[model samples]
Target: MQQTILEARHIQKQFHDPVTVQVLTDITFSVNKGEFVSVIGKSGCGKSTLLYILSTMDTDYTGELLIDQELMTGQSDAQLAHIRNEKIGFVFQFHYLLNEFTVLRNVMLPGLKLARYSEQEVEHRALERLKMLGIEHLATKEAYRISGGEKQRVAIARALINDPHIIMGDEPTGNLDTKNSEHVFEIFHELAEVHNQTLLIVTHDQGFAERSGRIIEMEDGRIIRH
Candidate 1:
């Protein structure tokens, strides 16, 4: 039996910017444990929108979203925040690390915020994540001092510090050069195959999507292929 990590049911979203525009329509999908799912689509195709909804960051949509089999449709803002911190790890294109902070500190932020463990434990976990990403040597370096590729690796380490159920990425390798992109892809691949981690990533790179465990193609606010 397969274990589902995330499920979206009959999701629909509309944006009223002077005129109503349907951004997503009836988007339904389920990502199972250890699955590396990639969502690919052209701009304005609603793939990113769907990701936001699934990540519990966008709550205006109509539908049911379940993470770890718990309904997330109507959770309070505080509750959603807790859920996000505890269950979902996010990696964006820009990395978003605070330039002034050390790489280790950046990774420890989420774990500290969650407060599930003591600060010492969080620091230990952050170092472990950095070691996993092969960047433990750079842990004390300032985030701004690292190369772009290394910064992305730090972001990945930070995402893993909390041991999230699913890691949601938005064009994680979009800003990297070919070599770095491939490196990031391989990391994600190993994470799924060896660690049984669930991942849902949105990317415009067809090659990246093709290499993932599964691909979900989107068009005109709907899933055209799964």
Candidate 2:
């Protein structure tokens, strides 16, 4: 039996930009544990919109979202915030690290915020994640001082600090050069293969999508392939 990490059922979304516009329609899918799934489509195809709903960040949609089989619909803001901190890790196109903070501190922020472990434990876990990404030596340096690829790796380390059940990325490699993008892809691949991590990434990169374990293609606010 396969364990599902995240499931979206008949999810529909609309944007009331003066005139109403449907952004996503009847989006249904499930990502199983250890699965590396990619969501790909042309721009304005609602891939990012669907990811927002799946990550529990945008609640203005219809239907149900289940993480680890727990219903996410209609949850209070506070409850949802806690759930996000504890269960979902996020990576965006840009590395959003606090430039003033040290690499270690940037990674430790989420674990510290979650408050599931002591400060020492969080620090230990952050270092472990940085080490896992092979960026431990950069831990003491300021975030703004690192190279673009290093900053992105630090962002990834920060995402893993809480040992999140699923990592959702929106164009994680979109900002990287060829070498760095390949490196990031290798990291994601190893994570699924060795750590059994579940990942749902939205990207426009065709090569990246094809290399993933599965691809979910979207078109005109609907999923055309899965």
Candidate 3:
């Protein structure tokens, strides 16, 4: 049997500012270990909102989130921060690499912040991750000096530095061209197939969604299909 690594139940969210609007309604789903799941939806259909909630970045919603079989909803902010750092890795559309840092240093930042390993151990592990992404050769380069695809690969390496249980991407390929997007898709595919890394990606690209292990489609704040 496949083990579920993450589960969301009865997720509902409302936004109140100029007006009160329900962004997510009755969102419920589960992702299994090593499964690459893609969430697809039109813009403003609450895909990002749902992802934010699932990511433990937005906690003002009503629902239950179980990650690794632990109840994560209603947790204290400090608790959530720790879980976000230790258990989850996030890749946004932008690479968000610090331009002033070396590629290797950028990858090593999270591991150092976690402080689970000595500096030497963290450096070794970061190098290993960069090698896994085939970017070890660029480790000494400044982050601003690399190509866009290379930057994305470095971001992936950084995400893996802490050995997160789940990797979440918010339109990870949204800013890339066709070639770069395809490259990223292949990397994500390999992460699931070879590394057994669980991934939940929110993407507008249909081709990307179709290639994932599972696709969840949302419309008007509700999951229309899966």
Candidate 4:
């Protein structure tokens, strides 16, 4: 059997203002190593909310979150930050690139933040990732000089610079055109199949979700299918 890379047990999330609202129900799931999984649901169904919790960014929930056999829930902010920097990669709907920085520098930022490697080593790794993603030619170009698709590819390279075990994306292709979206998906597919990287993507596009190896469908703050 494949090893479980991440697990969520009985996760419950709520919010309170004048009234209490449950954003996520008892969410329990496991993602096997090298698996490409997608979480899909309508807006307000808690897919993104659950993704945030799984990313270890939202600590207000009640549950046990285990990633690579380590219990992450209830960890202190510093500890969680360490985990995020070392083990998890994230891509959002927007490319989130630094427009003023060169593509190479943007990709090197995360590695520098991790402080695990020297500046030269980080730059080397970042350039290698850009090459792998077919964006090395744009490495010296500023973010604003690249096309939208190229910018997204640069973002992916940045996410991979630290070689995180799990890559999580929230609507990563939501801003791309159909062709560009397909290109992004193909890159993710290759990463999972060839590099054995685990991926957890929350997307609204049916074609994108369907092509992923597994789909977890949520509705009304609860998982309805997997």
Q: What is the lDDT of residue 127 in candidate 2?
A: 93
- Residue range 1-226, candidate 4, lDDT tens digits: 7889899999999989869999899999999999999999999999999989999999999989999989998799999999998999999999999999999999999899999999999999998999899889998998999999998899899889899879999999999999999999999999999999999999999999999999999999999998
TM agreement with the true structure for every prediction: 0.99, 0.99, 0.98, 0.98
Collision pairs in model 3: none
Give me the runs in candidate 2 sitting further than 4 Å from their true place.
Answer: none
| RMSD in Å for all candidates | 0.6, 0.6, 0.8, 0.8
Off by over 4 Å in 1: none
| C-alpha lDDT of residue 27 in model 3 | 92
Q: Give each model's whole-structure lDDT.
A: 0.95, 0.94, 0.93, 0.94
Which candidate do you rate higher for lDDT, 2 or 3?
2
Tens-digit lDDT track of model 3 for 48-96: 9998998899999998999988999989999998888888988999999
Write model 2 residue lDDT over 40-106, tens digit each, in one string: 9999999888988888889999999999999999999899999999999998999999999999999
Candidate 1's displacement at residue 28, Å, is 1.0
| Residue 175 shift from truth in candidate 2, angstroms | 0.7
Q: What's the lDDT for residue 28 in model 2?
A: 89
Q: Which is the winner by lDDT between candidate 1 and candidate 3?
A: 1
- Residue lDDT tens for model 1, 112-159: 999999999999999999998899999899999999999999999989
Better of 3 and 4 by lDDT: 4
Worst 10 residues of 3 by lDDT: 81-90
